[model samples]
Target chain A: MNVQDIQRILRADLLCGEEHLGREVQTACGSDMMSDVLAYVKEQSVLLTGLVNPQVIRTAEMMDMVCIVFVRGKRPNEDMIELAKERSIVVMSTKFRMFTACGLLYEGGLKGGCKV
Target chain B: MHYVVPPDDFTRAGEASSAVKKTLKQIGMNPDVIRRVAIAMYEGEINMVIHAHGGEITVDVAPDRVDMVLADEGPGIADIERAMQAGYSTAPEEVRNLGFGAGMGLPNMKKYTDEMTVESTLGVGTTVRMSVFNHAG
Candidate 1:
């Protein structure tokens, strides 16, 4: 699915990289723990997280992830947004809880990225 | 390019990673190898900021490998074995508030790099040395 589909499905607000709405995301993982995201994620991925920090953007950049969806209505600060923008990573925020947002995206056909 | 991680700023977390990525690109390293080095070094750099206050990162670009050494003189890991555990972490709540401390930093460092070694002493400091081989060669 594309970023547009994820936004519509999760009812998310695009915070940055609106030009990337058409970018495809085939897999995703949801976690507030950046460690688990780093440990378990595979392939080019989308990160669904409620965590807000410069490290979040750094992690996305490290994993070569294309997008990050902040759950629980959390919005990233300017520094975080700027970091994502520099890395060409899309950032979005949604009012849905983590589980709900993940479920919506899963139901929308984005699969879990790692099997291990 | 070499950098001394500033002790006071959390906003500048990924500067080392960006530099390494740019250097790798300029050197025409394989894109996959560049990604691995970037991820590994970035994680190590974040660890330095959150746990060590800051550190010095030295990147050695060789014909076959990219070598990274991250050295810090802050409080060191008490137990290297436990610290190396995939889910273990010593980062405090404040650091966690910054969205880390899930304990994958070291392991991810190991995962993305072809070789890694950690040397540490409690109350002293830690040094992480890792290298990623260029597959393009």
Candidate 2:
């Protein structure tokens, strides 16, 4: 599905990268631990995380992720948004908790992107 | 490219890796190769910030490979074997609260690189060298 679909499905607000709403994403991972995300994420284009920090954006960038969904309405600070803007990564905030957000996206056919 | 990681600056830890990613992108490296290099180096960079006081990262980008050397003067790893184990972190509680220090850093660094080596002296310093080959054989 595309970024727009995720936005609508999760009732998310676009914090940055509005123009990227049309981009497609096939997989996602949800985790608060940046280390786990870095270690296990494989080709996941969307990250659903509750953690709000600049390193979250950095993690997304390092993994080549196209977007991040801040679950539980946890808004990122200006630095995080600016960093995501610089990388052209879409940032969004959702009221859904981490588990719900991941489930909704998975129900919408977005796989986990890793076989384990 | 060379970068100095400021001590305990969690926010700036990935700068070197980000710069390297941009350079590789500009030079039109393969996306897979670029991703591997970026992730590996970023892990190393984060390790420097979290474990070491700070460190120096030198990246040598070649036609066939991207090599990264991260050197830091920190409380060296007491047990290299255990440190390499997933989920065995030595990072303090504050560092864990920052969403890192899960003990996946070194393993992730090794996972993404074609070759990797670690050298450390107790109470002195540690150095990690990693390389990712440009072409998949």
Best by lDDT: 2
Chain A TM-score (model 1): 0.95
Instruction: Write one digit per residue (lDDT tens) for candidate 1, span B3-114.
Output: 8998757778888888788778887888788888888888888898888899999999887898999999989999898988887988888877777787889988998899
lDDT (Cα, tens digit) per residue for candidate 1, span A21-115: 89888999888877777776467579999888787888788788989999999999987898899888999999999999988888889999777
On DockQ, the candidate that comes out on top is 2
Off by over 4 Å in 2: none
> For candidate 2, lDDT tens digit of each residue in B42-127?
88888888888899999898889988899999999899999988888889999888999888988998899999999999999999
Report every candidate's CA lDDT. 0.86, 0.91
The interface RMSD values of the models, given in order, are 1.5, 0.6
- Which 10-residue span in candidate 2 chain A carries the lowest summed lDDT? A35-44
The weakest ten consecutive residues by lDDT in model 1 chain A span A35-44
- Best prediction by TM-score: 2
